[model samples]
Target: MHPSTPTITAQPSRPPPPPSPDKPPQTFLDLITSVLSLLLVSSLTVRSFIGRWQVIRTKLTSLQSSLSLLSDSPHWSQNPLLHTLLPSLLSTLQRLQSLSHQCTLSSFPGGKLLFQSDLDIASSSLSNHLHDLDLLLKSGVLHQSNAIVLSHPGPSSDKEELAFFVRDLFTRLQIGGVEFKKKALDSLIQILNDDEKSASLVAEEGSVGCLISLLDSHNERSIQEQAVLAVSILASGSDEARKTVFEEGGLGPLLRILDTGSMLLKEKAAIAIEVITAEPENGWAISAYGGVSLLIEACRSGSEATQTYAVGAIRNVAVVEDIKMALAEEGAVPVLVHLLVSGASAAQEKAAHCMAILASSGEYFRMLIIQEKGLQRLMDVIQSMPSSDTIEHVMRAISSLSVSDSTARILSSSTLFITRLSEFTKEGSLILQQISVSLLASLSISDGNKRAISGCVASLVKLMEVPKPAGIQEAATAALVSLLTVRSNRKELVRDEKSVMKLVQMLDPKRELVSKRFPVMVVVAVLTGGSGECRKRLLDAGAYQHLQRLEEMEVAGAKKAVQRLAGNKLKNIFSRTWRE
Candidate 1:
């Protein structure tokens, strides 16, 4: 036993012989616990995936419900009765529905990742369709229902039918919402523009009063513009309509619009005022309302078109003497002269015409134009060789300026001014030619200027000899008379036998010349008053018969001039033959 104990001590050191390398074997309870842990993890994962699938299914169901409602809802298509009444409206509704469906599809669940481009395209298409629908509603063209009502045979005249439609539209305008009011006003404008009878009927139906009321009541720019535009269309070329507009207290609103409205509104108001003021009485009404100052202000600051209209209105109002003086006092001359150079072509033309009228008022206004450098502007227009209409306007303005001796001297002294005037007389339009020669005649009043114009004697002679307008003949003949007053210029006229013949032919009673007869006779008398050679030239051109024919007419100055020429000729022939 001692030996065994000793061995056991030694064997303990060999101990618990190295632990086993294999894992420990599980018991029934351990196995059950491991299986339960594995099953718990697997069940958690499966439940998570199942929950995700159910969430996706719920989203899909909600999407399907929304799509079903969008496609089937009657509210999506408003006013089915309207659609039935207008087949085109039905098409619009269908298109809108289809577009809405497309938009919905492109914007759902995975749209950001899959259908973003489709969404943009659908959105753009929808916007364009909406714009088209708006235009269709606002254009005021006849709808299918309106056409059907109009084309139906009945006792109603077309005018009466149109009137009924107009009344209906106006009723809608007064009673409907903003969109309906706009559409009705748009329709009224179109109808009034197309049919004169419709314009008259609308005016007679108190549309002027309604439109004026709308101008004051509606703050919408589009509505106000359409209202003013309707007023303009109704008043255009219709005196009674214009009177109605005035009587309906439209003038104050029109002027207010011109004073404070937007640019478009002001433009429309300007056009309306322009139409209404076409009648002189209406013009006085505008002036009486202190509109001249407003119009002048427009000329000073409005857009080019507005400026043109404003200047034109000023010119129309200036036909009244008091208004003319009022405009001149309001500093219209400088504004008009400013417009002459800087305005649009139409504005410039109107400005020049306005200048012509203002200049014709008196020397004060004439000098006003000159002081404002209007003469330079007129000359610039000539030098630029503008359109025919512009040329006529500028030339007329120059003629008006030339009425004053001081202004004529100022105009005649510009560099190449006489040459420019002479060129116009030589080869410009008939109006240009007339105005040019008239300017020359005015310049000829200065003894120093006659020498400058004498160089153009040939052009002057040609103008007289050519078959020209009576105004051209009158102006050219008057210039000749003025030029012949200078002794040095008489030789040029006496040598041109064609000029002599033209002067003699002007005196022929058979021609029945009124404006140019006296001037032509005076020039002939001056030319023949000199010597036997001039008288011989006249006699050879049959001046005796033409001059004798003038004696029978009731022209006092022409008769005296012809008699003086006859007396000189007879005395010279008698003296020369007796001496020979």
Candidate 2:
């Protein structure tokens, strides 16, 4: 026995085989289920949770059942809401497990209140996760996740596949987290840009309602910008989409963006507004939403694109007869005039266009423009000879303002305006010629403007000779008739044989762009205002045939001018016979 006891081997106690490390979760469903299993184990075995084990067990069972459906989902791994909620869920479970283990001890390590506080935190975290999961289930986020596969948009996918996918995108938009919505919006925008027909698809899917809902995201500028821009694309995509946007109560949110969003956002919102209100039928809703004031304010600040689109929106709204007064009251006219003075050419052109629309409402807007120093701004822009497109719109604004004698007097008094306008009649596009001719005619209504306009007669005559649209020619004829009221202008016209010949050529019935009556009126005006040489000039230019045909065409003033010419022709024959 002593020999056997001589050498006793010391055996190291095998530490309880390193409590089998829980297997790692391989997928989203596996990870979620693993946590649910841990919580289930904790409820059953943790001594401190004895009283609440049934409650915790019931909660986890329901959680497990709800998530089992997620396991069956094809794209469950892509559920952003699940991903976002997972970390919180895991952290709370770990904390609860540790805390519950500690609670099993005889005394509270951190005292009773501290232990209770830890328990409250763990409990609240679990409850919050459950609540969020419930909302996710209700929101059909699982279904939405399936649509998120559209992020890549398989190049080979057919329209039907894409359509089914888009239907899911809109579902997410109807109810998804902020980041999820951003992803959905990004995917939808790309789809729209890639496929020309995608807009109508999304619109038919009620995308307008989803997008408009995001415009109220005052806390999220990026989301707001993306949403409003998406709205703009859909709105401009087709008239039907625009109607959908209007029907979806989108106007209010867009105007809200104009008030609170960034400059770029304001531009996008304005663009959306422009497209929505493009139909005059939508104007009242904008006015009802108090968008007019926001739009006017937008024209005052923000980027050039913002101002331009804002002005364009106002112009569209102004087309509604009922909203015009409300638009003016919002100070749209003054704001527009201010832009004309200081804004970029594109914005100035749009501002001018909007003001032109306001002016058409009647004397009130015209006076408003004049009171706002719009005439001064108009002259300023015209002096610069802005882009042809800009000039065309500016000319329209000036023409609108010139519709009123009061505004006309102010415009006419600016020598630079008349000089620049006269220059416009000679050069630039056909629209410029027509608008300038019309503007000059309007200005010439005041006798005092005629001398300032006499310088324009040569250009007006040149416009007639250029063979342009009938509208331009008619406007030039009217301008010439008005200008010839001044003796100096008649001299300016009759002294140039080419000018008289151009006017006579316009009398030809074959000239489609010309109104015979206008040319005849000018001839009559020349005959009434010019000397006998003018009458002989008419005869020499072969105006008699047209004059005789004028009465048949219901054109007045030609017969009198024809008689004057006939008398001259007969007198010349008699004199020739006597001499013989």
Candidate 3:
């Protein structure tokens, strides 16, 4: 209304007064409520932590009680149950302590996170300790005193009393005169070699350490020989006993005996080493300690029995590939071949087995054996009418050697080799027949071998037709398959209507075709691929329905074979000739 002068416009009512900042400090009741809630949360956390701690403590207490019980039992020293359970309990305690330490470390001021790797390392260490303890327990050293008494079993002999007697004998050996110690050792050896159970008891009695000590410290050949024989007997008793002998430093002294002792001593030591190496780990130990070289030397120069034992030891250790190669490097191949050629029948058998193991190492060793004329020697063994065991070894050796194509050709070229093998298939034992047929199968891979084995086809078919062992039948079937691969062999097989029927019968749908199916199908496919007359003969023998059935099966090769047979049949029908 007053435009000229600064008109006094009606102002809008002012906004309500801004709120004041004069609120009272938090009240005591509110403070108390907040404190109570915080305390409750803290108490819950503390209770949870206490519960966890109590659980861990209870576990620790229980473990401690178990340990105390074990230690307090009077039979703890001689009871086998305690001997086994104590080590396990101790290992558990160790593991628990380790875990507790980890927990403590995790709660430390600057501790890093406990990683999975830490737990794994702890577990691995526990496992290894337990394994070592188990070995120690199984060694029977803990209960030896009781075992000796129980094993001896005299009128006045309780296990405890027997243990006392053994303890007395050990004491005498340590403090008595030289003659007394020698006599004690002689008696101990005699008792140990009485039987396997006695030997096991003596070994469990912890005589391995004493025997090894005697072998090392005494120069008496009789005592040493007897000690070696006892050790050999003990080692042969059980795998645990063998491991005990090796673990107690017996292997080194035994190897030394083999290295430098008299012929009789070396012979006994070699046998003992053989038994000791029955545990594969002991073999590794012996090879590591240079026992393999000494063994090879003994095999080369020792007497027939010595050589037998030494070569046998070599065979045991040669299971390790590196040791096998080491043996070949140390000229074992030639020595074994020589042994096979001229040694005693036992030596020859062992040498043949050793040669087979060596050859199986790889193609290189196989070739080495062939070059050493090992194969020729095996052929000679067969020619000389070796024993059944020797024949088996020789045949297996030849089978291993024949893995190489070149070796197979060389074998096939040997005079009377194939003939002898065929004769074995016809007239030998089941094992001999099986091995001979298998070798023939391998040799039959070559065309020349197929031709050579053709004459034996009837024998092979007869083996199948009769209720022979499955191994012989399977091997003969495989040999027939190889031989049937040749067209001439197919014609020969077709001529024997019985053999052709046998081949067809093997393909029956209900029969387990695990090994026979493919081979039978192969023979059928080969026969069916021949002239129409061959196909007609097979059809007459009831092969068509089986071929049709197999064509529908899941086997791809078998299906393809059926398809080929069907196609050939169709082509023959379409290309028929009609005469006026």
Worst 10 residues of 2 by lDDT: 12-21
Best of the two (2, 3) by TM-score: 2
Clashing residue pair totals per candidate (backbone < 3 A)? 0, 0, 0
* Whole-model Cα lDDT of every candidate shown, in order: 0.65, 0.72, 0.65
Score candidate 2 by lDDT: 0.72
Candidate 1 lDDT over residue span 155-255, tens digit each: 44576566656655665565355787787787787776666666667777544576788887345777888898888777773777877887898888988
True-structure Cα RMSD, model 3: 25.9
TM-score (C-alpha, index-matched) for candidate 1: 0.62
Please report the candidate that would top TM-score against the real structure: 2
- CA RMSD of each candidate after superposition: 23.6, 9.6, 25.9
lDDT of 3: 0.65
lDDT of 2 by residue, 1-580 (tens): 4566566643322212211123222343455566668667756766664666566667678778767765666555565555556655666666665665565552465687787777777777777677666655554445544544545567787766676667656656654567777888888788877777777877775456767878886537677777877888888888888889889988888788789877777787888888988887787887788777788787887678888888888877777877788877776777887888788876777777777677666787878888888877776777787777777777777777776767677777776677777777777688788887887766645566577657667777777655556577667888888877777667777778888788878888888666677788788777765466777777888888888887677778877877877888898899999999
